[model samples]
Target: MEGLALDTIIAKAGARPAAALACASTHLRAAVAEDAVWRSFCARDLGLDAPLDPEDRPLPSFKVGKRLREDRTLTNYMDAYKVWSESFGMYPLPLVKRVKLFWSSLKGWISENFPEALRTLSKGASEAQIRSAEDDLGFKLPMPTKLLYRFCNGQLPFSRNHFEDVRMAPLGIIGGYVFYDHSVNVHLSSLEQMVEETKEFNLDLEEQGLPIGPNLALVASSWYHPKTFILNCSSGDLYVGTANLSAGEMMPCVPKSLIKPTDSDMPQDGLLLWLEEHLRRLQNGMIKIRPLKTSRYICLYPEASPLCSSAVTNGVKVRASAVFAPEHPYGGHPGTYLYSYSIRLSVPEACMLGGVYFSSCQLHSRHWIIRCKDTVVSDVNGEGVIGKFPLLLPGQDEFVYESCTPLNGSSGSVEGSFTFVPGRVTQPEGKPFNVTVAPFPLQVPDYIF
Candidate 1:
């Protein structure tokens, strides 16, 4: 009730606020395991009459008033239950998919409309065979690669599959999410419909006078470096990027050298151009090869630091750019692709990414993303923010992964270990919110898997 940050509390509640607040979110089981106070509160106030609705479950005492600093306790306890249930869940709340849809749509519209960037090939291939297609297509791809590409091409086949799964997700604070398409949009609601509204988007970027005709599908670090991404949407002729959240006209990532893949150092006598021209010829039937000129590769979305800028193979610079897309459509777990690459290729002396494709052969579950810096770790009761490794400050300790056990003889508790480093990200202001929730019983999965 008294330990979490004020900004976090305000973020969880949505909208910027002047009021100071604190909370220690926990699962019903963890709440019981935490202290006798939570158990007594539950027995006396909640589960008193019947099974609890998710939105009406009891939560730990959280102090959220700027003026009434000490009033963290609840007489009804029902408010605690409702707030916690609304904020905490084993699967996502069926609404966060908006983040996925918006991004997927961004990719879909671009790739299909701006086909000049990526070379397209057959879709729905096995994990093993995808490599060949990518090699055939000639570009690294992100998860759901074919899906995002099709969507960009104006086909929305997998749109339903991408949005329907809510099991792997956890509710967000302030529902904090940043988005882009042809326009810079901020998502503020967390509901099924608003989640669906992102897809109905068909705003003519051309109507807005954007570079909708540019056949350049690229992945750049979002103007905002909130989360890393690897994207491949065919950006319209108009190039866009975000500036820090201070709010001004969003600017394009400068040094055009930063985002686009270049062969200047490894300049291969217009190899890139040759590849493009060759692909056009292949499509137009002007030329033919015994097999083809295609390849599967990964796109690294590195930080904008100079260290990231100097990526090379055999001392020759390769393409590298800004951080990952804030809302990557191909699922945001950059590690899966990185780890998979580890199995196939040697680590680059200095590797950074812009985006990747044709890396994995199987269709990925884009719902539960791999752990990222902004991952959120909140308890069922909405009390404390769990801390984790590398995120710790000069002298901070790790919050070991703890169990979520039932309290007061309740039916069950939501539980899992998530890492949080207070000063590590969103710096000088906000921090990353990486969280992992156990939707099913951990014991069952541990032994079964």
Candidate 2:
């Protein structure tokens, strides 16, 4: 019986007649439960080493083999096996250590990629401050949150907006105050404030009918619009609460609840995980910050008069400035000026830009080339300024574009016009019109004076 293969022996046992079974010879149950049998089965099925002493571990080879045969699901079993193997004689790293390591790596990455933004981060909070905050809030902060504050108290930019006006509160105000200085529409509240507001709104939680737990906390907020990021302190879950505001009243919270679970739409993760994921998204271009207005101006360019057609008040305003680009020059033209142009256009209303045509008075028509991001957009008789056109919104709205053109002469000027088409909703019968592009000087700095 020991020499026989396990499958052969089982087959033989099953093949016994009724009478032979009544006369029952061998201890088949004991044979099946034998250590050797289970060890072989475990090695064959799970590819795990058979334990020398089965009593040493909670999940022995016999139990593992039985589970594998009965369920045949490997995922859960593999996870358990990994935990059991790795944690045999070691304890996991403390949460504080793990968090410190994560912040260190994140800070290093931010410094390398966004040095200006990195400089805005505040110094770490002291242990006494952390304890005081915990006492005031009446809830223990998560280890990761505490660890994060140890590196940076909060990120506030005084002179310039960091990361495109996205500001984060200091540890003290994250749960209590809302930031209104940066935006007109958005407001972020703390956990205590959310709870108080929930009561102030006279919202019927019972009628609202979602699992409104007591563990809700405000993690982050954005004000460009009314959006709030929340975290469930108990379950480590995440939510986003958006409100429809009218006359300072929240329309979205009127009927059912002031705020409800938005599981389907929001990222479901802890605070630290969400921050890490957000940084990753920013790095990957999943997140973008559209510049609201132009930041600077150069006086070297002659401003083109605002061009207007029938019924348009201020038509379209265009401005241009030129700078030297040493990195990108005409392939073989040495001493030839490589001037990069920054152009901005302010549209008065919602309209579509059809195309832009570039012309130069100083450089030859053949030498004039419009290049974007080091790639040539058009040369001389080119079709458009860029491959794709964009639609601009109304009221002091601005759109920016950049292009590089080479000149054979020491000094030259470039001028162009943009084709505009008013939105059909605004002017149902309107046709496209041309707006003058401001001609800016493309002379080297040495010759500017």
Instruction: Find the candidate with the highest TM-score and give its number.
Output: 2
Please provide, for model 1 over 408-444, each residue's C-alpha lDDT reduced to its tens digit, 9 standing for 90 to 100: 2111222232333233333422332333333221111
> lDDT by residue for model 2 over 162-220, one digit each (tens)?
65444332211111111112222222243334344444332344455434445554444
Model 1: residue 96 alpha-carbon error in angstroms? 36
RMSD of each: 29.0, 21.6
- After superposing candidate 2, which stretches have Cα over 4 Å from the reference? 1-98, 109-116, 157-213, 223-225, 244-269, 288-290, 294-449
lDDT of 1 at 38: 31
After superposition, the stretches of candidate 1 with alpha carbons farther than 4 Å from their true spots are 1-164, 168-202, 207-213, 216-255, 258-449
Residue pairs with clashing backbones, model 2: 175-190, 186-223
lDDT for residue 164 in candidate 2, whole number 0-100: 46
lDDT of 1: 0.25
lDDT score, residue 423, model 1? Answer: 33
